[model samples]
Target chain A: MSDLKNNLPVLYSYFRSSCAWRVRLALTFKKVDYEQRYIDLIKNEHKSEEYLKIQPFGLVPAFIDNKSGQTLIESVSILEYLDETYSDFPLLPEDPLERAKVRALVQAIAMDIQPVTNLRILRYVGDDRKDEWARHFLAEGFTALEAMLQKTAKKFAYGDSLTMADIVLVPQIFNGVRFGLDLNAYPIASRLYQELNEIPEFKATHPTKQADCPEELR
Target chain B: MSDLKNNLPVLYSYFRSSCAWRVRLALTFKKVDYEQRYIDLIKNEHKSEEYLKIQPFGLVPAFIDNKSGQTLIESVSILEYLDETYSDFPLLPEDPLERAKVRALVQAIAMDIQPVTNLRILRYVGDDRKDEWARHFLAEGFTALEAMLQKTAKKFAYGDSLTMADIVLVPQIFNGVRFGLDLNAYPIASRLYQELNEIPEFKATHPTKQADCPEELR
Candidate 1:
């Protein structure tokens, strides 16, 4: 484990949740020390009475700032809250137009892609149909995302600096690869993910690196 | 139409889109006079070559700021841009914690609910399945939102002040009613929507008041 600062915030997360991964990446990028509290999602720990009080939706990656007594759910909202609260390494651009672009790009992933392919929803449809549903939805979203990324990308989704869009894209790409989706069709998205995976923060926050992940998954 | 101010921004919108109604509500609350350019979605004006150049997604409620030569898409982004650019009406709260709460509420509606029930996605799935999909998805979202709103609401979604959350909720509830979904299940959401519709700005921005809406629909 990395050396964490004293009295760091606590992050309640599950090993494989993409939404939790987004917050983990943001915390790593911001270099904020946070203690990880693993929620055994397979055991349905998230739906336990204790966990539901922290997050009514029973979603993973509920953040608790001990210093301020603030508990935040919803990954995007948590990211924005962190960015505003810590003003050190700004995740958002100062320019209004650029900020709007970054936000729109992030929303493209958050709103358009991720929710439709979430594991809980996939499981809701049962194993027999899960693969087909995942592929169809992810492919449809990725095609549009690939086109948009090609228009705006320089080094990352919105140019040189790694913004919130890059944070969101990496995990979705991971899920895409796991599902055996065709990466060739989304060359820009694939290339960007290849490049992003090399970064230390992303490497450290990979799902396999999480403490709760079994040795085989690792 | 209501005492126009020369050189104000131009809003590209559809008559009945909830996303478009969001911008309309914001413009009214901010008391900013602007021109409205209607895109006839029924006739496929939004997907027209001319419209695609402005918004690649062919989504309604793109805004063009004549003064700054900036164009913005996505209703939430546009609302944020407007709030930041025109600091008069204060659509978001000054406090970071409150701002986070408001954003979480807005996103619950915009990201979680509206996308699933959007017109374009509905058409993609075909008419036979659209109503079923819309009913199931809206209820899933409304249950969560109703719970959250019950905790945070004073008169609006986040207290007495009219914030962006209220702007998003009113239109979504309007859409819910159009689909004949039962509002009785979400009493808080229904009450808030009823309160919001009584406001002059919201009343003026109603779909029935739009120039292009058919007489039968009106």
Candidate 2:
């Protein structure tokens, strides 16, 4: 049912997967020409045994390079690899300390926030309590994020340059609105989100802009 | 109740904090002589306003570098900073692809595995069926980790070297045992866990060996 059998540098992605959206931003920013394979999470396409072969975690946005035939999973790792291999729009800062700061910001959302507030946990909480659970975790995470962003943000998440932290921030802010999170509470992050969305790469790779986002959502 | 004030490369750690343990392993491997400041999660020390200044997320394993006076939160970020700052016992591989692979593995555990089965989620699920909840999430995470390790692992989590992936695995595996999850289900991870634990660096930085571990538990 899918043409996943390919040799070209392929991205196994889903339209609404914020994790997948992060990859799309990196690939687009670096100006790398690559093929996109939409894995419909709504249809449970990502959980198939075949898909699991590509991403053992059975998550969207698994990447495979045509050059080395390397299958890279995990958004941060994939972003790092593309940045290293492309060398065009370097996602990481030059200084190790700055790079570490950017990475810490990246993981603060990726590890702490996203995982706690994701759909899997939501379903576990059940529909009656999902919104409460989502908002609680999102606000909790954003509280910390707001404080960190205050210290870290200059023009973007880490200085004037749009590092990996900014790429990660876009979708998280979008999700905050979706979960009915008050953007006013995280003033710095909301400002940075607006600034980041001005860039074509960020806008183009947005959840609603994706091909598989469905007609109504678009 | 604690000597929580210091600035000599201090680590906010706990006896059984796996997140903090990752930092300990990195510091030990790099042979960095740093001061340890235990934040007792059980005593709600990490949740205090003063501690929140050190770590906005109110979590343990926050590190402040002596030289740069940079306070780094999140275990992976701190681990990475230590790796980059100290040249000894490099935690990441030289090759970009290999490093990405290692990082992906690190996050596979750090983001996916650990966050899902941590104390936060366990408390959310409550004690009535916490074991079942933990085992389910842990097994799912480990299943993917096991499959990924089978391919990437030679002796350790990523080849023969003790990379960050291995550092992450040791604690997760310990958690697997604690949750009463049968290690036999994941052959590769268990064997690699054994091989990794044999190292002095791994043994020395273990959760049980830390100073704040309660006497009876030790």
Candidate 3:
């Protein structure tokens, strides 16, 4: 990794991490130039004392905006920060009501679905139960999410414009597929995921396409 | 339950639910006059088709803004809507960095800590292991949160005036205590929870103090 200058925002991320992927997509979507510093979760680099100083929670995707001297940890907050700071391509709609709808979809995945099956939780519960636990939670949450998507989806998760909802949705769908979930079970979500996967922002920041991705995955 | 007119934004909530409690506190804090319609999670009322139409996620704390004709699910989104629509006694800080910081703390608890130990997840993992799982995740997450609170707290999770961090912190601390975790282990969080508990807003919105609270708990 190259040493970051005071002018560039550095993102500490792991290629396979869903949380980190959300921020990467946001940065790319907003057309913000950032330095990507890999934190190898497989080797437990995120839990290091030095990294913990950057993110007290010992999680991936901590971002440092050197120009403004702002450091943000959570993916949701980091994405919001990028959207607010860049302002060229707004991730959230201008109307407060529309913004709330987009945010609801983001939290539905970020808060409700993904966290329960996070790597740390899986490790704590034991390796033997990981796949079963993940599949069950992902499917159960997606059942509701599918129903939600049916009501709210247009060209994207919200409407024609790509919003924060679509940004969060893509990585979570990636998680679902990685966990062996049959996307066909949730047809609405499946279709949206397939369509959104073709977008340039989603394509560029995909886990498999990342600079630090494993050779086999890349 | 009173009939909600086209004028009031009715909150679909269950008093015992930590997610619902956050919205309740936010509504009370904002001094928004709204109707409360109980959805008994214990009775599986949230899973009913009628209720599912309102919130496809089958989660409590769905808010319907009759005035705006918007129905929003997810506590964080609802809280943001309340902040934006009401614009009095703002839950989030105006400065983007401070708002991002406050949001990070909210996601720490809402996304990282709370989701792993939600009632649905607890039931899925088996009742025998519920307390063990809840305590383990809560303590681990709080260790990090304690460090965060140490760095950021004063009279509340952020500073003197209450912000989104305190709004999220209180209910999560409530969940921790409910699960039998000793708050004393994290002195900073314990102090804030203790102090915040003494305020009228927190007191009035306490789970046991709610209209839907069971008789014994009440």
Candidate 4:
């Protein structure tokens, strides 16, 4: 890894991490020129004392903005920061209530779905039951999310615009499919995933297309 | 339960739910005059079709704003909406990076800790080992949160003033103590919790002080 400079904005990310992928999408969509510093989760680089000093939480996808002189942890915070700092492409809506809708959808995945079914919890669920557990929580979360989308989704997760909801939704869908969930079970979410995956921003930023994805997987 | 009129803002909450409690705090701290419409998770009321229509996610702490005519789900969204719409005592900071820091601290509990140790996941962990599972994840999340708080907290979870970080943190600390994790382990968080609990707002809105808390628990 290159030494993180004070001038360039940095994203400490792992290629396949859903949390990190959200940051990548935000940067790409906003057309921000930021450097990437991969924290290999498979190698337990996030747990190292060196990484801990930077992000007390030892999580993947920590963002450092030279302009702000702040190293931000948590994907939601990074996403919000990027949207606020780079106003060229806004990820949230203008109306306060509309913005609230967008954020609710984002948290459907962030707060409700991701934490319960994350890699850490799966490890505790044990190797044998991991897939089963992931599939169950993903499906349950999707069931509710699907119902929500029915009322809100127009062309994207919230109307025709691509907001933070879509940013968070797609990668979570990626994880669901990886855990053997049939996307058709939640058709609205599945449709949005299809529509979002077709966007140009997704091509360069897909997990398989990242620098660190294994050759066989790519 | 009173009829949820369009004229009054109503919070769909169960007093004891940590997520709901956060919403209650935001509403109280903002000094917004809102009514509570209880959806008892203990009775599986949240899972019913009637409640699901209002909050498709079947989660506690859904909010409806009279002015916007919008029903908002997710505590974070509601908290943000209350802050934005009311604009009296702001829960978020003005500077973008500072706001990100407050939000990151909010998610340290909301996304990382709450989802893993919440009532829903504890049920999955089974009756025999619920406290054990809750304690383990609480300690791990608190350890990381404690480190971060040392850098940020002064009087509250963020510096001196009450922000969304404190709103999210105190309810979570309430849950942590309920599960038998000693608060002293995370001194910074504990100190803030101590200061926050003694405030008059908390006294009126604590879980034990709420309308629906049963007599024995109260």
Question: Pick by TM-score: which candidate is best?
Answer: 4
Q: Model 1, which residues run further than 4 Å from truth?
A: A1-6, A124-130, B1-7, B124-128
- List model 2 lDDT by residue over B1-218, tens digit each: 13324545788898778898888888888888788888898888989999999889898779878877778898998887888889999999999999999999999999898987887777777788789988888888889988898889997789888899988888878876898677889999888878778889888888888888888887
Of models 2 and 3, which has the larger DockQ? Answer: 3
Compute the lDDT of residue B156 as modeled in candidate 3: 77
Q: All models: lDDT?
A: 0.82, 0.85, 0.86, 0.88
What shift in Å separates residue B120 of candidate 2 from its native position after superposition? 1.7
The candidate, 2 or 4, that scores higher on DockQ is 4
* Ten-residue stretch with the least lDDT total in model 4 chain B: B1-10
* Of 1 and 3, the candidate ranking higher by DockQ: 3
- How well does model 1 score by local distance difference test? 0.82
**Candidate 4 C-alpha error for residue A174, in Å:** 0.8
Which of candidates 1 and 2 reaches a greater lDDT? 2
Segments of candidate 4 deviating more than 4 angstroms: A1-6, B1-3
Give residue A120's lDDT in candidate 2 (0 to 100). Answer: 67
**Per-model TM-score on C-alpha atoms:** 0.91, 0.95, 0.96, 0.97
Restricting to chain A, the TM-score for each candidate equals: 0.94, 0.94, 0.95, 0.95
Q: Where is model 4 chain A poorest over a 10-residue stretch in terms of lDDT?
A: A1-10
Ranked candidates, highest lDDT first = 4, 3, 2, 1
Which candidate ranks first by lDDT, i.e. highest?
Answer: 4
The DockQ score of candidate 4 comes to 0.88
Q: For residues A112-152, write the lDDT of model 4, one tens digit per residue.
A: 99888888888888898788889889889999999889989
- Predicted candidate 1 versus true structure: per-residue lDDT over A1-218, tens digit per residue: 12224767888998888878998998888888889999988999988989877776677878886556677778888888888888766888888888887887787778777776776566654687678877887887787687677778999898888898899888888887777578888888988989999999999999999999999988
